[model samples]
Target chain A: MNSVAGTGLARAVGRLRGSGRSAIGRWFVIAVPYFWLALFFLVPFLIVLKIAFSNIQLSMPPVEPIVTWAGDKVFQLRLHFSNFTFVFGDDLYRAAFLNSLQVAGISTLFALLIGYPMAYGIARAPGTWRNILFLLVVLPFFTSFLLRVYAWMGLLGRNGPINGVLLKLGIVAEPLQLLQTDFAVYLGMVYSYLPFMVLPLYTAIEKLDLTLLEAAADLGCRPTKAFFKITLPLTKEGVFAGCLLVFIPAVGEYVIPALLGGPDTLMIGRVVWDEFFGNRDWPVASALAIVLLVILAGFVLLLQKVQAREKEAA
Target chain B: MTGRRSFFVLSAMVFGFAFLYLPILSMIVYSFNASRLVTVWDSAHSPTLAWYVELFHNDQVLDAARLSFRIAAVNATGAVILGTLAAFALERYTRFRGRTLFGLLTTAPMVLPEVITGLSLLLLFVALDQAVGWPSGRDATTITIAHMTFSLAYVVVVVQSRLATVDRSLEEAAMDLGARPWKVFFVITLPLIAPAIASGWVLAFILSWDDIVITSFVSGPGSTTLPQLVFSKVRLGVSPDINALATILVLIVSVGVAILGVYMMRRDRRRARDAQAAFAVIP
Candidate 1:
C-alpha cells in the first residue's frame, strides 16, 4: 500500500513539472518581445503623445502633475492644441519646413543620379572585384561622420583646399565662394547619403536576370534601348527603395546644414533644436516633432503601399 | 556586350572610384604634408610626422576617442542580444495578426529621420523623469539606450535574413530525434547562425562607432564623442590634427575590409579548385 502511494505521488510530481516547463516555454516566446518593445520603443512614443498634451505647469519637479480646464474646472491632464498653433504661427518654422523638403528632395534626386549608374557598374563588374567595390562604397561610412563632414569644412571653407586648388590651377583668379552656399550644402548632403542610395540599388540590381537583357537584345532592342527598357524597368523597385532610404533621412537632416549651410539653409531639424535647447520651449519642440512624425508617417504609408503593389505585381 | 558599351561602363566605374577616393586619399596624404595648408603640392614641403605626433598628445581628442570606443562596445553587445532575440521570435514563431505591424515597428526606427528619433528620445527622457523620477537625467546611459534602439534594428535585419534562408527541416529533424525545441534551437539553430551573429555584431559596432546625430542629442556633458569633438574643433578652426585622425581612421577601416576580402577570396578559390577536381573525376 505504501509503495502504491509513493508511485502515485511520483506521477503527480512529474506531470506538474512537465506542465510547468511547457507553460514557461509558451510564455517565454510571447512575453519577452512584448514587454521589451513596449517599454522601450512603443512606450516612448506614447510618452511623447502624453507629454505633448500635458501642461508644462504640471510637469515640474515634486511631480504632483496637476491640470487645468476652461473656467477653472480642474483635471489631472488636458489635451492642448496651442503648441501646434504656435509652431504654425511663425514664418520661421514654416520656412524651415519648406527648406528641409527642398534640400532633402533635391539632394535625394542628385544622389540617385550618381548612385544608380555606379551601382549598375559595380553590380556588372567582374565577380572578383565586386566585394572590393562594395566595400569601398561603404568604407566612408565607417569613419567619424562628424569628422567626415568636418573634413569637408577643410575642403569647402573660403581658404580651404578646393578654393586653393582652383586658384593655383588658374580656374578662378579668386575663391569661387563655394563655402556657405546651397551648392556646398548639397555637396555635403549628397556625399554623406550617396552610400545609402547605392547599397539598396546594388542589392536590387545584382539580382537582375542577365537573360532578360539578352531576351531584349534578341528582340531587336539596341544596347542602350535594352538598358533603358529592360534594365531600368526591372531596377525601378530598387531605385524607389534607394530614393526613400536617402530621401526620408535627408528630410530631417540638420547636421549638414548646420555645418555647411548659410543662414538661408534653415532646416526644421535646426528649428527643433533651437526650440528645445536654445529657447527651452519644450511644448513647442514636442509639437514640431509631432508634425514631423505625422509627415514621415504619411510618407512611410505611401512607401508601404507602393511596396505592396510591387510585391503583388512580382 | 559591345566595345562601346564596355568603354562607357569602364570609364564611369573609374570616375566613380576616383570621385569617391580622391578626397579621402588627399586627406590621408596631406596628413603627413609638412605645410600647414593642405592644398599646395610641392615635394620641397618635405612631408613631416608632426601632426600625427601632436594627435597622440592631444588630451581632449584622446579622451573623446576612449569614451566613444567604450560606449560603442557596450551598445553593440547589448544591441546584438536584444536584436537577435527579437528576430528569432519574429521569424520562428507562428505568423500572427499583427506580425506586419511588429515588423514595421522593428524597422521604423531605422527608416525614420535621425533628427526625429533623437528628438523624440530626448522628449521621452523628459517624460520618464516626470512620470517615474528614474533616469531623472540623461547621460551615457541615455546615449547607450538610444544607440541600442537603432542598432538593434540593424542587427535584426541581418539576423532575420540569415534565419529566413535556414533550412527549417534541420530543426524539425532534430526534434524528431527527441531533442526538445529549446535544446534543438540552442544546439542547432545558434551554431548554424553564428556567422550571421558575427556579421551583425560587426555591423552594429560600426554603426554605433559612427553615430553622431543621435549621440549629439542624447549624450551628456563631458561625454563628447570623437566625431563631436572634431565637429566642435572644426567649427572653431580647421586643424591638421583632424586630418591625421581621419587618415588613421581610413587606414584602420581599409585594412579591416582588405583582410575580410582576402579571406573570402582564398575560400572562393579553394572551393572552385575542389569543384574542378570533382568534375574531372566524374568525367
Candidate 2:
C-alpha cells in the first residue's frame, strides 16, 4: 500500500513537471512565430507605410526625410498623403488597376467553373483513386512555373503547334494571335491557379456528408436540383475560400502579364514593378504597396466574414 | 446513377487533364526534334539528341542551373529545420496564448503576393545594408532567405499535422522509464514525424526550385537562377535552346517524382509487412 502511494505521488510529480515544461514550451512557440512575422511581415508593411508617406528624392535615404516636424512647423520628413493622389491621378495607373480587377475577376470565374467540376469529381472518386487524382491536380505546381508558362507560349504562339494543327485541319484560314494578348494572360493565370482552386474545393467537398445529397434525392429532387439545393450550398465555403485564394494572387500577378500580355494589358502588379525597378520612384511604389496591403486586408476581412457566416449557418 | 452526370464529369476530367498535359507532352517530344522549328515535323529526318547535348554544354544555362540547385538545397534544408522546430513547439506545448494568432502569422507569408513579397524583401535588403552592411547587395543569400520565408510556412503546416497525430503516451512512457526529455524526443517522437519532415523537405525544395518572382527581385546581374534565366529568355523571345533547357528540367523533375513515389510505395509495403509480423507474433 505504501509503495502504491509512492508510485502515485511520483506520477503526480511527473504530470506537474510535464505541465510546467509544456507551459514554458508554449511560450517559446508563441514567441517564435510571433517574432518571425513581426520581423519579416509586419515590419515590412510598416516600412512600406512609412516610405509611402515620405518624400522620394533619389538621393534622400528611402526611410529618412531631410526635415523634421515640430507642431506647426511643416517638415520634409513628415507624413505626406500626396502619394495616394499620384496613384489615383495617373490615368495609366487607374487603367492598370481597373484592368487588374477585370482580369483577376474573369480568371477567377473561369478557374471556379473549371476547378469545381474537377474537385467534385475527385471528391466523389473511389478512395484508392482519390490520391492519384489529387496528385495529378497538384503535379503542375511542382514543375517550373516559368517553364509551364513558356510551354503555353509554345502552344499559343501564332506559328506554334496550336495554329499549325488548326490550319492543317482546315478549321481556320488564319493562325490565331493567341500569344501576347489579354486572352493569353487569362489562360496563363487560370491555368496556374487552377490547382489552388481545386485543392480547397476538394477539401470542402470531401468533408460533405453524402447522406445530405441522398436525402435531397429521396425528397423528390432531380440530380441537378439536388446538386443545386444540397451540394452547391454545402461546398459554398470551399468555393468562397478557393475564389479568394485565386483572385487575390491573380490581381497581383505581374509575371503572366509581363510575359504573355499585350502592351494594352497593364496590371497593377506590373505597374508596381515598373515603379520600383523601372521608374525608380520608391515613394510611389511604396504607396502602391500600401494600397495593395489595404486591399488585401479588406479582402481577408471579407473572407473572414464569409467564413464566420458559413460557420453560423452550419 | 445519373448517366448524364457521370458523362459530363468524365468529359471534364479527361479534357482538363489533356489540356494540362498536352503542351507538356509536345514540349518533351519537340526536345528531340532535329529541326530548329518545333512545330513542323519531318518524319524522314533523323531525331537527334543534340539539344540535350547542347543543354549540357551551354555555359550560361549550366551556371544558372548550378546556382538554382545550390539555392534550393540550402533553402530546403534551412526551412525544414526551422519549420519543424516551430511545428514541434506549437504541437508539444499547450500553454501558449494566442495560438490562432501565431497560426495566422505563420501562414501570412504563404498568401502574400509575390510582387509584395519581392518588394518587401528588396526594401528589407536596402534597410539592412544601410543599417549593418550585411548582404551588401541583393545576391544568392538574399534569394535563399526569401525562398525560406515563404516555403517554411508550408513545411510547418505539413510537420505540424503529423505531430498532432502522434500518441503522447509513448513519449510519457519513455520519460517514465527515466529517459531525458531530449532522449525521449529523439527515441520516441522523431521517428514518428520523419515522413512528414521528408515530405516537407521535398516540398520546400520544389518551391525553392520553382521560385522566380522573389528571386528575380534580389538576384544580382550574374546570379540569375534557372527560372529567372528562363523568364528573361521567354520575355525576350522563344529560342530552341530554351525548349531544350526546359525539357531537361522536366526530365529531372519527373525522375525525382518517380523515385519519391517508388520510395513511398516500398515504405508502405514494408510497413504492412511489419504489421503482419506483429500480428503473427500475437498469441
Candidate 3:
C-alpha cells in the first residue's frame, strides 16, 4: 500500500512538472496557501522585527519609522538599538524572561509527572475502554480555555472550595492563600496544558508492543525494571513532543498568570501585553516579542532536527 | 504483583480524571447557585436559573457570542481550505522550490506563543493600514484573519498526518482508469480524507472560538470575542452570569464533541468491516 502510494505520488509529481495545465493547477494549489502565509504569517514577523528597531514615539501610531521619504526621495534613516538595549539592560524585562522560563519549565515537569501515569494507564486499559478514556482526556480541551482557568479561579479563591475543604478539615488555621499566587498560576498551567501532554504520550504508549514487556517478564525482569528499561526509553519521543507542546505556549501564557498570578508573578507574556497596551510602548513590546521568537524558533529548529534524525534512524 | 500494579494504575487514573474534571464540575454546580456571589453556596436559598436568564438578556454577552460565532465559522472554513492545500502541496509535491520555507511558515504558528503572533500581526496591520489604506482599522476581518493564520497551522498538521497514512493505490488506481487528477482528488482522495477534514474544521472552529489573546490584541472597538469578554469580566471578578455562560458553552461543546465522536467511531467500524470483507474476497 505504502510503496504503491509512493510511486503514484512520484508519477503525479512528474506529470505535474511535465504538463502545462496540470502544472498550473499544482502551482495554484501551492501558491494560494503560500501567498496567504507569506503575507499574514511571515511578513508579520518581519514587521515585528522592523518595529523592534524603531524608536517609540508619542505620535499617532506610537513609533518613529526607521526610514522616511521626502517627496519620493530618501529623507533620513534612523534605526534605534535603544529598544533592544533597554530590554537587555532592564532588570524588569530580564526577571520577566527568567520567571516565565521557570514557570513554564516547572509546569511542564508537573504535567509530565501527572500525564505519563494517566497515559500509561489508559494505554494499558482494556481495548474497549481505551477510546473512552482518550475521549475524556480530550473533552476538557474542547471547552473554552479561558473558562477552564476561570473555573480554577473559583476553586482556588480565598472563599473558594479548596479553602472551604481545607478549613473544614482543619488543615490550616485560616484559608490558604491559594489564589493570585505563583501556586495558582502553576496549577492553572498544569490543568490547562495537561491534555496537550497526555495526547502525545498516549499515542506513543498505545503504539508500544506489549509483547516486549511480556518477553522481559518471561526473562525474569521485575515489572518496574522492565518499565524503566523498556517502556520509558521507547516512549521518549512522546515525552519530548508532549514537553515541547506544553512548554512553548506556557512560556508565553498571559491569561493564566494575569488572572491567577499576583503582581509579583512576572511573565514575559504579560510584560509584553503591558508594554503594548498599558504603557503604549510598541517598539519595546516588539523588542521583547522578537527576543521570545528567537528563543522559541531555536527550540523548534532543534526539535525538528531531533525528529528528522529519529526518522532517519527508523 | 499484577494486583498491585493494577491498583496503582486505577488509583492514578481516578486521581488524574478527578483533577481534570473537578474544576469544571464545580463551575457547573456554582452556576446554579441562587446567590449573586459565585463562591458562596447557601442551602437556605433555592437554586435558580436567574443567571442563565440574565445571560440570555445581556446585550454585551449576546453580541460578543454572535461576533465570536461568526468569526469562528468564517475562520474555520478559511483555515480548512488553506490548510488542506498546504498539506497536499507538502505531502504530494514533496520537492517544490522553497518548500523548506513553506514548511516553516505553516508549522511555526502551531507552537509560536500567542503573545508573539498576536503582537506581530497587530503591528503588521498597523503598518499596512498606514502604508496602504487597507484593513482601515482592526475589526472582525482582522480578527478572523489572525485566527485563520494560527488555526491553519493546526489544520495543516492534522490533515497532513491523515494524508501520510492514506493509501496511494486508491488515487493511482483511479488515474490508471483514466480519471483526471482533479477528479481523482475530489472523487477519491477527498472522500477518503473527508473524516480528517471534518475533524480539522471542528478543531479550527473551537480554537478560533476559544481564542482570547490574539483576538484581544487585534480586535478594535466593536470586535470583542466571547472569550475576550469573559476574560475581562473574570479579571474584574467572577460573576454568576459568566458562570452560566460558561456552563452553556460547556454543554454546547460537549454535545458537539459527542456527536463527532460517535460519528467517527461508527465510520471506523464500517471501514474496518469493509477492509476485512475485501481481504476475505482476495483469499
Candidate 4:
C-alpha cells in the first residue's frame, strides 16, 4: 500500500512540475510588473526626453509639439535644442547644478562623519543591547520625514529652544541666524539622512570577523591602525552604498532646501520646482531633469564599474 | 586602552542618539505649551491641551488626514500585489525574456530621486490625459498610482531578499505530496514569506503616508494630503497644532513599531525552539 501511494505521489509531482514550467506561467508572472513599469516609469522618461527638445508654450499642455502631421507629402518635425543650450549657457542654471553637487557632497560627508561613529558604536556594543540600539536608529526613519524637518525648524528658529539655551548661556548676544541658512540646510540634511548612512554601515561592521582584528592586535598593531588597514577596506562597499544612498537623494532634495534654505541657496531641485510651478516652463524643467538624470546615471555606472573591478580582484 | 575605547564608543552612542531624537522630543513637548507662540515658553501659561482639542476640530486637517489615509491604504495594497509578482518573477524565473530590463525596472526607482519621479509621473499623466483622456485630471487616483510606482520598488527589494533566503525544497516537497503548483504556492510558499509580505505592506503604507513631494506634483486641487497640509502650514512657521499632530503621529508609530518588535522576538524564540527540537531528534 505504501509503495502504491508513493508511486501515485511521484506521478502527481512530475505532472505538476511539467505544468509549472510552461511558458505561459512564466510570461504571466513576468509581464505584470514589466508592463506596469514600461507604461509608468519608462514611458514617462521618454516623454520627458521628448519634452526637453520641445519649445515652451503658454498653451494647455505647455510645450510646443516636436512632431506634427502635415500634408501627406510633407511631415513637419520641429525640435528645439535651445532649452539645453540655455541651461548650459546660462550661469544661473550652471550655478544651481554646481551648488546642488556641493551641498549634497558636503551633507554626505557630514552624514558619514556622524553616522560612522554611531554605527561603529552600535556594532561593537554588547550583543544583547544591539537590537534595541539599532531600533532606536531606525525608529525616526519610519516617523514622518517632513515632521522631522519641521522639528529642526522649531529648534533652530530665533526664539526656539537651541537659541534660547544658547542665549541663556551667553553663547551669543543675540539669536544667531540659524534658520534659512546653509548651516541649517546642512544640519537638516544630515539629521534627516543619518539613518540611511548608519543602517548600511552597521550591516557591514556587524558582519566583520573579530578574529582578524585580534590577529592584528596580537601582531602589535595599534587599534586605530588595524581599523584603517583591516576594517575600512572590508567595509568599503558599505561606505560606498551608504554614501550613494544619502548623496543621490540629497542632491535632488526639494523640501529641506525650500523650507530651510534662503533664496541665495540655489539647488537644481528647487530650480526645477520653480521652473515647472512658478515659471510654467515645462521644456526648461524637463531639460534640467534630464541633465540631473544623466549625472546620477553616470555616478551609478561608475559605482558599478568599481564594484565589478573589486569582485574580479577578490 | 580597552577602557578608553569603550568610553569613546559609549559617548558616541549617547551623542548620536541625542542628535537623532532631541528635535523630535522638543516638538512633542511643545505641543502642549499654552502659549500661541511656539518658540516661546511663557511660565505663567504653562502646558495645556488646547492645541490637541483644536487639532481635532480643524476641518481642513481632518479632511486632509482622511484623504491621505485613504490614498495610502489603496496604494499600499496595490503596491504589495504588484511587488510580490515582480519578486516572484525575479526569484523563481531567472531565464525569462527581458529579464535584465525587468530587473533594472525593479531596482531603479529605489534610488531615483523623488523630484524626478514626481515630475515625470505628472508629465505622464498630463500626456495621457491629452492623448487618451482617461484620467482627466490629477486627483487621488493619480497620487496613489505615483506612490505605488516608487513604493513598489521598496516592496520588491524587501520581498525579493526574503525570497532569496527561503528554502526551495519545501515547495518541491509540497508538490511531491500531490499538490498543484498554485496550491503549493498558496499553502507552503505564501505562509513561509507572509512575514516579509506583511513588513513590505507596512513599509509601503508608511512610505505612501509620509510622501509629500510626489503627492504635491500629482495632487490636484481639493485632493490635499496630510503631509502637504502640514508642510504648507510649517512653511509659514511652526504652529502648536502641527506640534500636536506630530506628537500624535509619533505615538501611533511607536505603538506600531513596538508591536512589530514583539512579534519578531516571539518568532525568533519559536524558531530557536524548533531548531533545538530538530537537533534532539537527530541525536
Best TM-score among the predictions, by candidate number: 4
Which residue pairs clash in candidate 3? A5-B168
What ranking emerges by DockQ with the best candidate at the front?
A: 4, 3, 1, 2
lDDT of 3 by residue, A124-218 (tens): 88754776788899999999899999999899988898999989999888989888999999999999999999999999999999999999999
DockQ of 4: 0.75
lDDT of 2 by residue, A177-236 (tens): 899899999999988889889999999999999998788788878999888888998889
lDDT of each: 0.80, 0.83, 0.92, 0.91
Tens-digit lDDT track of model 2 for B50-157: 778888888888898899999999999988887887788677665566667667767878777898888887777777778798878778888898888889899999
| DockQ per candidate, 2 decimals | 0.52, 0.49, 0.74, 0.75
> For residues A87-108, what per-residue lDDT tens digits would candidate 4 score against the true structure?
9999999999999999999999
Give the CA lDDT, 0 to 100, for residue B141 in model 4.
Answer: 94
Give per-residue lDDT, candidate 1, residue B270: 90
Q: Mind giving the per-residue lDDT tens digits that candidate 3 earns over B116-202?
A: 999989988988898898899989999999999999999999899999999999999998887878988999999888989988999
Q: What is the lDDT of residue B66 in candidate 2?
A: 91
lDDT (10s digit) by residue, model 1, range A1-314: 99999999997997787668856875675566556666667877765566566545433421223254536565545577777777789898888888888999999998888888789889998877887798888887676667667667777777767888788899998887776778878888888888889999999899999998888788888999888888888888888889898888888887788888887778888888777677766667777878888987898789889888978988
For model 4, residues B116-169, the per-residue Cα lDDT tens digits are 999999999999999999699989999999999999999999899999988999
Q: What is model 2's native contact fraction?
A: 0.49
Our tally of clashes for model 2 stands at: 0
Interface RMSD of the predictions, in order shown?
2.4, 2.4, 1.4, 1.1
What is candidate 4's fraction of native contacts? 0.78
Candidate 1 docking quality: incorrect, acceptable, medium or high? medium
Task: Please give, as one word, the docking class of candidate 4.
Answer: medium
